[model samples]
Target: MLFTTPTFAEEKAAEKTEQYDPKGPILEHIADSHYWHMFGEHSLPLPVILYTNKGIEVFSSHVFEHGKEEYQGNYKYALIKDKIKPVTEAGEIDTTVRVWDFSITRNVASMWMGMAILLIIFLSVKGKYKTRAGKAPKGLQSFMEPLVLFVRDEVAIPNIGHKYKKYMPLLLTMFFFILISNLLGLIPFFPGGFNLTGNIAVTIVLATITLITVNFSGNKNYWKHIFLPHIPVWLYPIMIPVEIIGIISKPFALMIRLFANITAGHIIVLSLISLIFIFNSLWMSPVSVLFVVFMDTIELLVAFLQAFIFTMLTALFIGMAVEEHHAEAH
Candidate 1:
């Protein structure tokens, strides 16, 4: 039989005078003590969980538990205060979310960075256009004009053919958006701090857009080649399935490649910095910082490389779909 014991009157009085001290090593470790505002050595990978008093919480599994005792099975939350906390029923929190989660997230921070970069490029080109007084372009315009012409001449013209002008706007917009967003991800400060390109949702959306465009833009010849190829009759059945799967898989590959590469770079950089804290060695601090800085530099190049690769592959795929193969004369 289970018995619930009630405190004696004398024991209750003694307990009140003694005071119930909540402070302990476990509490100290779990408490939000560190000042994130101060840019210094004290940084901990505290697991941040979002919760509402109304019974909803979102958080990473990694930092939620401190030890075996702290493990609450699915009950991950540790009560910080008894008071009810107000939170959105669904959607992003503008405040109180952990910085790492914020950094990894795709949000307004990333959107603004992408917009700002595009604005700068367009304004600079426009400025040059005005100064030239209807003459040949110079400076920024000179640099950008060739790229614009190259996309028209090399990418759009060759792939989309004589009717390429119709699709030029979409192609150009996609290329520049991907390029600028990728580049912005490499920046470690304010506008660039958020890893927009690293997020799978963003990549998937972009890939889906490309997939839709490629299939929708296909000509009659494109569909004929995919459904009923010019190959052997016996091979058509097997080849048809493979070819259709390949068509779907290409854009999926694009989504994974971009997302993995960007996310991996950031994780690596963070891991390097985390080493110093893990070791708790003063000597290791400088080395870790230097290594992280070096990695950040490499990421800058990777940003541009990924953007170019994605754009080039897209052009290649479009080229394949639209390329006209004439029947050989007997």
Candidate 2:
């Protein structure tokens, strides 16, 4: 079941006393974990892969029983704060031993699923183009054609100029990946609501790719403007540092903007629903449900808006780097 009611004796008793705490559940929903939580007490356990001082350790996350028990492998390991780490014989966190986790967490799994979805979609769209050549776009091609053209015409050409074709793949990938992931997150079901884009680690990676692309694509004029601006030579020392900071800051803004917007949307929706349990009144459900629907409508628009904004800014930054001066053109 996607959602459950208080049916068990203990759960009913807790409801009677109204000891509900929304913090833990809310945080867990927005954060990545070793297992994919479905609803209620049901979850799909994932593999726990760890590199420790003793060597590699692999086990099912189920062994920890959602962190209620400690698992003894190459060395004792415990799931603390949703992370698997080495623990002492006494069950204390063993700080002496170094551990590196390469496990496929919920977010990683969600990313793979999202990637698979994108592959199926674009591949189908690609095949249709050849088979349906010279014909008006129909079916999926008709659906996706406008979006593809939107990125090219509305976003890329306006920002990156004639060189936009080279970066179309990157910009298209960014837009669809983020858009699909955000849409999936709003679903309150097993395969969805994984919070992939809302995670900081994911945003950092997306932003870093943009940063690398922007810098690598920088033209001779781009570097010249940064290192040898039209400023007085005396101000070079100050402007040089500022120019370098600008390069880093652009991507940093992209990272924070996506992470904060998606995360805040989830938090707000969850917080609104939390009011029902907080007040312990069925009367509040109607009001809460109304607000949730309204916010969800807004979130749907935001899902598309954020993806567009991120792609737009990335193209804008690339445009800044690859643009030529009028003097050079002459």
Candidate 3:
């Protein structure tokens, strides 16, 4: 009987070892974390800054040791599912203390890095323009000149007309920021793979900026079209409300489009990589690797396409707002 008991326990342990679940890990990878994760168990912990009812407290995220341990700040705190929350001495989550986390997370750090890269590239190009002064382009200027020209000639001039120059700065900023952020998310190494664009908060801010710009730039014709449409008097109630909704919906659509596309791309790539582990077969590596490469190539194109689409649409909207209404000659 004793021998049989030991055999049963061994079999159960083997079964547990063989079982694999990929959902938890996949979700964790896509979501934001306090520390910037590198390959395997290596990760750089970011600073943890919190504002609580007691006062402000600052520390390192590593103090929690990936949620395996709790740390004492101004109050007792624990990392609950990658979130810093106050906990009671009884080892339970404390609901009374409200915590405002102002920490620089993986996404925030990546955004700063992206902005720095953009500044360095553009500032160097600016200096070249001053020194060269109408000479043929070379090196970094050659690469960036075409993209800048495309946005101006193909995107801006076509939609926004002569007044396009007024909004060119905004258009350029949106296009390059989105393009760089999307490309950065596709990288699989440290300081590059953080999904800055995929984060919803970032998208919301971008959309809000577009919303403010569009409405503020609206001329008299644009205001008339919204509040006092050229429709029958009886349809005023119906069409007026519709026009108001349309104004808000445009930017809302932009927000969802960018957020969903970028996030889905990252999830698909991660899910593909998880397939080999799920199958528990060395043979699955070649098949999974091939699909991952193919998808990555498609994603590379999509990064540019999404940026172009966003800028093109914004220009179109701005043009609509600023267009002059021409009347028929008598």
Candidate 4:
């Protein structure tokens, strides 16, 4: 669920020996991409939606070979140093031209796919609730009912009080969206390798939404506490700024927490699996495989843990905002 950024140690090792740089491909797998990988050297193409001085230029990512090649559209573009850039007729990058990529990359596609899955699941469960009102929940209904109830009973009601109902839809949506996206990244194969939640862009959007929701839904008392604290008048100048920073800090923490947790899991799993190639020996396979199995089990737990932490923190923030009094929830 994270994009690869080369670490100082990795860069130093690369400089020492120009051989078997496993980190590059590992990072690419957990990164935003122009194609959906099916397997080795094969992938499904995504459309490049770019707007430039020439006009709206659209093309298939297949036209270029995994950033190793270039394509000519209204303007020529090459994937240079992991970025798509415009190039001159001589195949040199033309810094003068500006290219805006609004392309639907793999991560974007995975997000849409995850939402579609959620829609199907909830719609099916809703239909079941209507048809079998008093009966025991069956199949998919049985599976999802407990999770839905857990968030409401454990997260929302305990934190947000009676006003929990107003935010259930948003909370449920966030929880499942994150859970599913994290699970999708664990698949490591076709239709699932895209790292949606690990992407800072996606996490930032989620944090921003939570930020907006908290501030907007906050009551008069909330603002009063932030701007005019319980402290003395002389401390107002210092306290007010601190309180204000707290507001932004909550969401900032959320963004970093989710991104780091998810990305780290992917890196650890990939690094574990890479030991075999690094050794270049048949004997390393047994130890590497066993360790990888252990890591995968841990990652499975993390997939759910991250979702729970994110949702719980969100509920806690909302609780802090919408409470009318120091002791009261709502």
Question: Which candidate number maximizes TM-score?
Answer: 2
Better of 1 and 4 by lDDT: 4
Compute each candidate's TM-score over C-alphas: 0.63, 0.94, 0.91, 0.91
**Which tens-of-lDDT digit does each residue in 77-139 have in candidate 3?**
888878888999998999998999998888888888899999999999999999999998889
**Cα shift from native, residue 155, model 4 (Å):** 0.9
Using lDDT as the measure, name the better of candidate 2 and candidate 3: 2
What clash pairs does model 2 have? none
Error of 2 at 139 (Å): 1.0
Full-model lDDT for every candidate: 0.58, 0.87, 0.83, 0.83
lDDT of 3 at 190: 78
lDDT string for model 2 (1-330, tens) is 123211222343576676766665677778888988776667888888898768877778999886789998888888887888889989889998888998989889888999999999999999999999999999999999999999999999999999999999999999999999999888877888678889999999999999999999999999998898888899999999999999999999999999999999988988888778778889999999999999999999999999999999999999989998787431
Span of 10 residues, lowest total lDDT, candidate 3? 1-10
**Candidate 4: which pairs clash?**
none
**Candidate 2 segments whose C-alpha is farther than 4 A from its true place:** 1-15, 327-330
RMSD for each of the candidates: 13.7, 2.8, 6.7, 4.1
Candidate 4 residue-wise lDDT, 1-330, digit = tens: 222332323543564454456677677766787877765445788888999998898888878776768888878899765567999989999999999998888998989999999999999999999999999999999999999998999989998888999999989999999999998888866777767888899999999989998999899889988887677799988988988899999999999999988888888877876666577567998997798789878888998998988898899889878886855331
Q: In model 1, where do residues sit more than 4 Å from their true spots?
A: 1-106, 130-136, 157-163, 327-330
Question: For candidate 1, what is the lDDT?
Answer: 0.58
**Better structure of 2 and 3 per TM-score:** 2
Candidate 3, which segments miss by more than 4 Å at Cα? 1-18, 327-330
